[model samples]
Target: MTAVTTDPRTGMTILDEDTCWSLLSSARLARVAIAIAGDIEVFPVNIVVDDRTVVFRTGEGTKLAAAVIAPRVAVEADGADPATGRAWSVVVKGRAERLDRFADIYRAEDLTLPDWTGHPKQWFVRVYGDQIAGRSFETAPT
Candidate 1:
């Protein structure tokens, strides 16, 4: 059975770890946030959950460059059931490592992450989720 938590302050609900993982797996797109030169930036990318880790692909660009400098990153993915007015959001904090080894790259290829752009995305970034949290809320009726 899935557990649900209710907040006393606003009646919002908190999701358990199991529920969070389920939502993460169902999400196809997420925002990868990283700090670059002391400034924070968020980039939207297609992602997949693998072994409890969030994986995505990017090419030689600001996103890759920043991840190289700052290994730690935070990722956020969210979804809502419009009919029910129930929404859930998940956030993961972890270390971002670039996979360069042939074996690692080969394994990542199996993920089959899609790139919306036609450009080739060779660089892969795997975020080892160290801490994860999620929450859900039922909006007031319209």
Candidate 2:
């Protein structure tokens, strides 16, 4: 964790860029939001953070199209600590690009990518942006 910020009123902890990437690198599931036509679509994807980018697999359809065509995109992941009941969320905004080159694909294969979907995910897309922010705070009992 490089830097941390706190809100006096709510006691919320703000996470820095390094911390955000750290959380993202450990997270397996995340939601990728893309803009298509005039609307926005979000999809749950299993991800592996390679360097500073978020990579996920998808089959042909809207998700694939969005990844290829969308000018900008956002990927978000969150987690909660059961012991402390503290929840945190991290968001990454960046350009979505497909891995079409042989070297890139081969490199991606080396990483541990966990996919829950039984269907074939032939296409690999990576999202990377300059903006990333996160926060952690105590959660009330349910």
Candidate 3:
């Protein structure tokens, strides 16, 4: 396991870009937060990451409806290392758009959504991250 050494000037633990991308790619699930009817709703989704976009399947419910009209959304994923007392988290702010039939063809080759018990409409949402930020936590030498 690699350790995080803090920068003396900024006092923030530095995580390399590759390390951050690795963490993002390794995450299988993410929490997608959307605004609906003046209420903030968060849904746990099984997502597949494609470069800077996140794709997932959902039913024609609140999440789907919101994404169609309001594509602006937030998605987050994180993990922590208990032994090292270190943790990392990344948040993606992006817009969600419904996938068209043409785009579906490409996604089919690269991603698959397992069948589950739910409304089987199989709505697909693609989130394009406009801004991505991440942070790593480390305990100062005591």
Candidate 4:
């Protein structure tokens, strides 16, 4: 539980930083959106939460290239609780950097994450969210 903001019209709850980070810590799948070559591209990534940062593994491709270029990116995750008719979404906007430091790389190695692609992912990228926010709302009745 975080900021209990209820919209006067919609009853939407605005989540605070701590609640946002809590949701991120429990979620493993997120979409990373990056702007590259004058276009916006989104990538579905398997991520691990390192405190307030999001970390994922990638190969030398657009995802890696965009991170190296130092562009502001967005990582978003959402969840729905049907029984409670509640749906929530959290977004993290920040810069993505490649984990090149020895300590960072070593620590990342210990973070066991499943690779659905089963490809050789040798690079670790961390997204530092400059702004983080979330909202919770009641789903429309069927």
Candidate 5:
């Protein structure tokens, strides 16, 4: 864990980039958001952090189609301790590109991501971490 700076106004703590990346790397589940038909949609996926990018697998569907249309997307993961109200969240914004090439897919196979849906998730998407940010805080006892 890394040091945090508290925001007096909101009583929240700001997490640094290194901390954010570490959090993301340790997380297994994340929410991926993309714009489709002018409306933004979010989907929960089993993700793995490869270097600085978020990688996941999906079958041919809305998410796969949306990525083809608009590569820019946001991936977020958050967790908290309910008893103490200590929480943290990380957001990654980047272009989601499909790995259809044999070499690309082969390289991604090394990551060994499991598909929870138990479907044939042949398509792999990589969201390059262009902009990453996160926050963590300890709230007053409720």
Candidate 6:
């Protein structure tokens, strides 16, 4: 078992820099939501997190088409703390872009995802977060 320490400054349950890095490294799946034509669209995606960048695969139809044109999007992930009856969540707000050859090579070293379903027309999309915010809540002990 591993223990996580909380920061004092933000009662919001601080995830230390190292802990944040570890969580980002270990989490494989995340929900990505984007505002499309005044509607919210969300999809469960297998993701590869590289520092502040998130990458995932999508087919050519809807998700990809939206990403190609969308100006902003949000990505989120979270975990629960049983002892404290609390949970923590993190959100990233940023722009979406199709990786170019240079970025593909740079990100390739850390690329990790479950084996892709056989989909030939699929493409990879990366979201580079410009802003990040996190929060946590805990119930008073009984």
* Better by lDDT, candidate 5 or 1: 5
Q: Give one digit per residue, the lDDT tens place, for model 2 in 17-98.
A: 8899999888999999988888999989999999898888888688888888885899999998889888889999989888
Candidate 5 lDDT over residue span 1-142, tens digit each: 5756887988677788999999988888999999877899899999998888899998968989988898999999998778778888999999999998999899899996888788868899999978998988875677
Deviating ranges (above 4 Å) for candidate 2:
1-3
CA shift of 107, model 4, Å: 0.5
Highest-scoring model, TM-score: 2
Cα TM-score per model: 0.91, 0.94, 0.75, 0.92, 0.89, 0.72
> Candidate 4 vs candidate 5: which has greater TM-score?
4
Ranking by TM-score: 2, 4, 1, 5, 3, 6
How would you encode candidate 6's per-residue C-alpha lDDT over 46-81 as one tens digit per residue?
778875688887765778878877858888877666
Misplaced by over 4 Å in model 1 are 140-142
Q: In model 6, which range of ten residues has the least summed lDDT? A: 1-10
lDDT of 3: 0.74
- Model 1, residue 139: distance off in Å is 3.2
- Considering every candidate listed, which one attains the maximal lDDT? 5
What lDDT does model 4 reach?
0.87
Q: Which stretches of candidate 3 lie above 4 Å from their native place?
A: 1-18, 112-121, 139-142
Candidate 6 vs. true structure, TM-score: 0.72
Q: Which stretches of candidate 6 lie over 4 Å from their true place?
A: 1-11, 14-22, 100-110, 115-121, 139-142
Clashes of 3: 0
**Model 4 RMSD vs true structure:** 1.5
